[model samples]
Target chain A: MALRRQVCFALYAASRATTALYRPLLDELGLTYPQYLVLLVLWERDGRTVKELGEELRLDSGTLSPLLKRMEAAGLVERQRTAGDERVVEVRLTAAGTELQARARSVPAALVAATGLDRKTLVELRDTLTTFASTMDIAAQELAAKKK
Target chain B: MALRRQVCFALYAASRATTALYRPLLDELGLTYPQYLVLLVLWERDGRTVKELGEELRLDSGTLSPLLKRMEAAGLVERQRTAGDERVVEVRLTAAGTELQARARSVPAALVAATGLDRKTLVELRDTLTTFASTMDIAAQELAAKKK
Candidate 1:
């Protein structure tokens, strides 16, 4: 198990490196990586429940709650309890948050360029990682259940 | 720019998922994911400088210092300032730390099995990610310079 060549290390390194690359690009737009992700979900479909946001992002309430609070403070999103269900809090984009999308359009192309791999290879890698994540999630669930 | 299809998102998800998979495994050894990474580096080569560990792990001193302190508290590592250069702190594994290697041996195989990938595909993906990380690092440096 060479540390340099380990798959887990590769994933950690690549993900951090990608985040580092995005730092400057996103900084111009006043967005942290996780915040950008939250925005991405809302950009695709506005007014998702905080529960739905957490499920989509694989984040827990503790983490997503504070993040959403920060986003609300920044005027990017506004959270409200649905009248029909007080337990259901929905996250909807603000005018500024929705308009930030126009400025954020350049972000993805910037990351693709930094990858240094052609479109097809990058797409393949993304799809493979996505599949690997699903498998790992299942494994984690099994491991957690076995522990119980 | 579909959020689900973004390479950045895939990388983030895969990395976090892998870390989750490693959580229970590492917890059994009383180690966190970053702590496990430190042990992996130390297992390969003992007594690396704090700066060296930071570079190897791509962590800033602010992050690494507390981690090393925690490891020291756990009797897994000891840090000493070099006699010749008091500025440099060396991290050496303790007897307990050195012995933890044998226990950690099964950890890598467990992760690989959870991955559900054949050897060849995993190797290729690791190599690709390694290269991608390097390219992204260079891009980050250039962006930093441009910002200056």
Candidate 2:
């Protein structure tokens, strides 16, 4: 296969593999991979608006809305419309959500050990992928603009 | 975020970004990204059994069965239960499926340009991710075995 084709498939397969590895771990926490991601962002800095969270996660409201609703139902997060701006809904981690972070810390640790790659190698891989994703996102935006 | 947390998110985001970039291109071809991947494997060597395709793609039967059914409905491929082993369903590219390969060649070219990364860097990244995914898969299996 061409390098370009292999690159995309590699990323796709790796992402799914990572998620599959996390499945059992997250299941015990009653969270899915995406839900865990939302918590990761919240754990970093809580009380983010829906738009902010969407921007960080590269997820639109159409996808985030239902996900947030489910998270709220699970009692991990609470969404409240701002009094100052009714249109803006802020998502805050619940007490349970905040408490879950301590346990969630082990997930990444387990994953790192699972990869068996040295810290430096993993960091380089992460940085490269981050830059790649950003470049692709820009290209996608330009393509969408051209379609308009 | 710690490097550990960021690594998984990086892969997750990059995979989605890659898929998003392919969305428009594949849409024109009336193929979803996963479906295109299935065709890629078939084009390489047609008449692969469902099990073989699943192994190559790292997809389970639950996922591949429906996907193959959709592709069959679209006349892109045909699936037949082998006479020698009725349980083994072999997937072969149809005339349309084989012809689509010509047009599909442009996809990787477009993606390469979109990413703006040098071919060498992309190739290295692909190789690393493929290995990373394989390692994680083994870890997941080990974890599952421990649970049992």
Candidate 3:
């Protein structure tokens, strides 16, 4: 099969392309794509533990730790160990991060406009891909279990 | 729209999920996902210039240079300035790279099995994403032009 025709390659390319489109927009907010995703989760619900954020983002601590560190250093977020549960590190958007949400509201609309795809089509495509990812996650678990 | 329901986030999550699925299969080949993508292009057609590879892969020189360097160091591929055009650097697979193709063919199959999606569905999804990406590219170009 041609690399271009491969489903995995198509997802890989489309993901990067979409991220590239967001680059200039997100740069104005001083955020990278993944960092922007982190903020997206936090914006939806604040003060999530690292485990909660990782589950929502499907990212492990290895990847999330340094990224959270960078976001904290940028003063966009604060990470605190919970007093009741010392092992749990909760991430909360700082004032700057919360304020940035107002500006970020325009991002999804701009990205939708950039796709030039109708709302129905965009939603359908997203739903399909989301379902596919969920199926793959289940399959991956099976594969890992077999290995064990 | 909720962040979880956003089309871009769905694509981002799906892309990473699929890559994570490929991780173990690719690890056996000593290849990262991007590096495996580079080899996919090279395996299809040998001796492509960096520009050509970048165009096919939609990667900038900065990202491609280091990746090509790593591939070269691993002895999977070689990069050299063309004798006819000193400005052009061509990437060609070494013997090991060519031989690795036999082992690499299993990767796609393994990934397909892991996804648990039938071939037809996978192909259709891939085509949809490819077309979506192309449309987004044009829209991005228009957006840039309007800004100017």
Best by TM-score: 1
Error of 3 at A69 (Å): 2.0
Docking class of 1: high
Q: List the residue pairs that clash in candidate 2.
A: none
Which residues of candidate 1, in runs, are more than 4 Å off? none
Winner of 1 and 2 under lDDT: 1
Candidate 1 reference-contact recovery = 0.84
lDDT of 1 by residue, B1-148 (tens): 7688899899999999999999888888999999999999998999999999999999989999999999999999999999999999999999999999999899999899988899999999999989999999999998888879
**On residues B43-62, what C-alpha lDDT tens digit does candidate 2 reach at each position?**
88999999998888889999
lDDT (Cα, tens digit) per residue for candidate 1, span A1-148 = 7689799999999999999999888999999999999999999989999899888989999999999999999999999999999999999999999999999999998888877789899889989999999999999999888979
The better-scoring model by DockQ among 1 and 2 is 1
Count clashing residue pairs in model 2.
0
Comparison by DockQ, 1 against 3, better one: 1
True contacts kept of each: 0.84, 0.81, 0.75
Measured by lDDT, the strongest candidate is: 1
TM-score of each: 0.98, 0.96, 0.95
Please give the lDDT score at residue B94 for candidate 1.
99
Q: Arrange candidates, best TM-score first.
A: 1, 2, 3
RMSD of each: 0.9, 1.6, 1.5
Residues A13-127 of candidate 3: C-alpha lDDT, one tens digit per residue: 8988898899889999999999998988888889999999889888999999999999999999999999998999999999999999998899988988888889998889989
Per-residue C-alpha lDDT of model 3 across residues B1-148, encoded as one tens digit per residue: 5677888888988998898899888888999999999999999999999999999998989999999999999999999999999999999999999999999998888888877788888888898899988877777777688879
